[model samples]
Every structure is written in C-alpha cells, then in structure tokens.
Target: MGETFYIKNMVCNRCIASVLDIFGKEDYTVESVELGKVSATAGKKTNKSALASKLKEIGFELIDNETETLVEQIKVKLISKIKSGETEHLFQSLAEEFGKTETALSKLFSKSEGMTLEKYTINLKIEKVKEYIQLGQLNFSEIAYSLNYKNSSHLARQFKTSTGMSMTEYKNLKSWNRKTLDKIV
Candidate 1:
C-alpha cells in the first residue's frame, strides 16, 4: 500500500497539481493527490527528504503530528464545502461530517488555528468574492447568489466590512489583489 502523507497549506486545485508535479519529478508513484493529502509509493531513486524540501520550498508543509493532520483535514473539508456553495448549517454539517460534536470541533479548530472557524469562513467567502469580481463575468447579485448570500446588499455589507472597499471600487482598481486560498488565515 502507498503511504499517505498529510500536508499543510494545500488548499486548492493548483496546490494539488503542484504536489503531483513534485512527486512526478521526484519519481514517486503517485496514487492520488488531493487537498492536504497524498498517497504515493516512493521509487527506489526517490529521496523522501528532498521531496519534503521541495514541498516546503513551494509553501507546503508535510504534517506529521496526528492533531495537526486532523486540523488540516478540517480545513480541507471546510474549503470544499465553501467552494461548493454549501452554506446552510455549515458548522453543524462539519461536525457531523467529522463525527464530532460542534463544540469539540470548534475548540479543536480554534486551538490549532488561533482563529475562530467562522472568521476563517468569512475570509474564504471574501476571497471568493474578490475572485468573482476580478472575473467580471458575474454581477453582484449573481456572485452573491452563487456564494449563498441572502442578496447582493448583504454580500456588499460583508464585503465592505471585510475588504474596506465597495465592490464597485474594487472592480475599478487598476490592479486587483486576491489572496491565495491556503493563505486565507
């Protein structure tokens, strides 16, 4: 069986692709690559230390502690849910998904991340909103709907609160600055 490695700071499809590339270059037989985890068999020529170093060079960390691994899993699950726009009962669903009580999960996340999960979720939503605005394909209402906001005005309020600028002002900027998914915190 291939060994499974839990990774930190792998929060998007590009991160998965980057991990796959690193494994491929290192001659590992990659079975699968997903957000925050990989299953792979090391080839005879593969250097584990080198592989870890390369991942680190690109802002990914190989997580060894069990608690840290679980925290990374929580981050991956929450990011997946947000990307899918599953906003209803987010906390309750996350607890159920992990087979833990909401309070337990909240405490664990808070202890490890040094921020409340709700704040993290809000940060994610704001980043996603920035992406939508940059794309210029969707209007405010459409973006709000896709992100499961009550309406454009609600999204606008949250956006202004988070970003310190109106969406129109953001859209009018000469350059848009959006944070990478893994760097949300």
Candidate 2:
C-alpha cells in the first residue's frame, strides 16, 4: 500500500509536473500525482519531513490533517472550475460535486482557511477578471459576461472592493498587478 499526501498550492498541470520531478529527484516512487494529492510507495528510509521541506522551498506545503487536506482539495477544485471558462453554479452544486453537505463544507472551509468559500471564489473570479483585462481583448461588459457577473457594474464593484481600484484605474495604471491562482489566498 502507498501513502497519500495532500499538498497545498498544487493547482495546475505545471504544478503536478513539478511535484513529480521533486519526487523523482528524491528517489521516491510516485504511484500517482494529481492536482493536490500524491500517492507514493515509501522507501525503507524515506524522510517525510525532509520531502515536505523540499516542497515548501518551491511554494508548496504538505497537508497533514483531514480537515486541512479537504480544504486544499476544495481550493484546487474551485480554482480549476474558475479557470476552465465554464459557467458558474451555486454552492449547492459545489457540495454535490464533492459528495459533501454544503453546511459542513462551508464550516470546515471557513474554519480551516479563514475565509468563506464564497469570498474565496469571488477573489478567484476577480483575479481572472484582471487577467482578462490585462489581455485587453474584452471590454468590461464582455469580461463581466464571460465571468458570469450580472453586469459590468457588478463586476466593477466587486473588483474595486477586492483590489481597491476601479476597472478603469486598473487599466490606466503603468503596470499590471496580478496574482497567480495559488497565491490568491
């Protein structure tokens, strides 16, 4: 049997590849590597803490508890959905997707991550909006529609609240300031 380790900040394909490379360099036999979890057969002398330290050096962290692991899994799924260019859904749908009750998941997420899932999703959407704006391919209304916001003004209000700048101000700035998916929280 192999041990499964949950990792924070492994939210993309590049992250998956990077983690596999780290396991390879350390001579660990990785049975599977997914967005935020890795299953590996442990060697006789494997050092979990040392491997964890190595992961931290590259902006990842090992999750030890079920609550923390679940929190990271929720984050990974939410981030993936936001980046997939798909339609948005209610929190109930998210709960159904994870096979958990919405109330339980909401409490766990708020307790473990210090933010409600709704706030986290909003932050993720705001980050995506910044990316769209940076590309300069869409106006505010278009960006709003693409992101499933009710209207351009609604998106602008959320963006301003999150970034302390209006969409126009963000566009007129000398440089773009954007955060990556893993760094959003």
Candidate 3:
C-alpha cells in the first residue's frame, strides 16, 4: 500500500495521463500519483522494479537518481503553473513546497537541464502568448499582463530573444513555427 516508484520524463499532463492509463488497464489500484512517483495500493501491489520495463514498453522511462527526481518535480510544477495561468502565485508557494530557496531551485534546474530556469519559464510564457495572439482575443499588452510580464516591451524583448524575432514579427513571419515543450521529465 505504501510502495512508491519514480518515473523519468514525467514532465507534462500527457505524461500524467499515460501513467494512470497503465495502472487502469493493468487493474492495479494506485494509492496516489504525482510527477515522479506512483504509490501502490497494498493488496494491489505491482513490482516497482518491473515498472521500468513496463513503463518503457509504453514510452516512459524510470529515473533513479535523487537529483534528477527533484529537478523533474520542480519542472513539472512550473510547467503546470504556467499552463494554468498561475505564474504570479507560484514563487512563494513553490519555495515552501520544495523547502528551498527559489535561487537554489533555479540553480539546480539550470544545472540539470542545461538552461536557466528563467529561460525555460519564459519559453513557456512565450508559447502561451503566441497562443493568445493566434486566438485573436488578446492584444499584446493584455497578453503581457496575463503572463505577469513587467510590461509589453519586456514581453516583446523575451519573445524576440527566444524566437529571434519580435512577437509581431513572429506572427507575421511568412512561416510560423509552433513551439514545443521541453522534455523535462
């Protein structure tokens, strides 16, 4: 009932669905599930050692290192917060949940993922901004504010840096490239 297992690349909502689907079909009643772990129900035990084999058979991998596990948890939480429009509320909440300085989280995130956490976060914000632009419901200032940017110019600066073009240029580019999420799991 208390067994827990770690999964590699459990970085997004789809990854969450993937893990739950596996347990559902296998008829294993899961006690709980989170970014990097699944707790097994006592009478419904499934071997943790075998999860690696089974998970990979379905495309997820199990990560064993302690540091990678922590990094992935942070990444998943950050990604979800960004996706759900909760960016401004996350910093204090996350510092408490992880029991570490945001500086510490940023350093570990950069060390593990080969990019600054701010860069990763801005990439996601840009993606969402682009979505709003495409939807035609929000103008630049509104989009910037919704994403917690200091101002439209700041959002424009970040958008340009990440995609090598201004948000206006990106939308008007002869060819538009949709952004992809990082493989943070």
Model 2 regions lying over 4 Å from their true place: none
> Each candidate's lDDT (Cα)?
0.90, 0.87, 0.76
Candidate 3 per-residue lDDT, tens place, 140-183, comes to 99898888877999999888888788888877764667655544
Q: Total backbone clashes of model 1?
A: 0
Better of 1 and 2 by lDDT: 1
lDDT of 1: 0.90
Ranking by lDDT: 1, 2, 3
Ranking by TM-score: 1, 2, 3
Error of 3 at 113 (Å): 1.5
Q: Which pairs of residues have clashing backbones in candidate 3?
A: 1-42, 9-185
**Deviation of model 2 at 3, angstroms:** 2.2
Q: Give lDDT for model 3.
A: 0.76
Candidate 1 lDDT by residue in tens digits, 49-100 = 9999999999999999988898889889888988888887888998998899
Q: lDDT score, residue 52, model 2?
A: 92
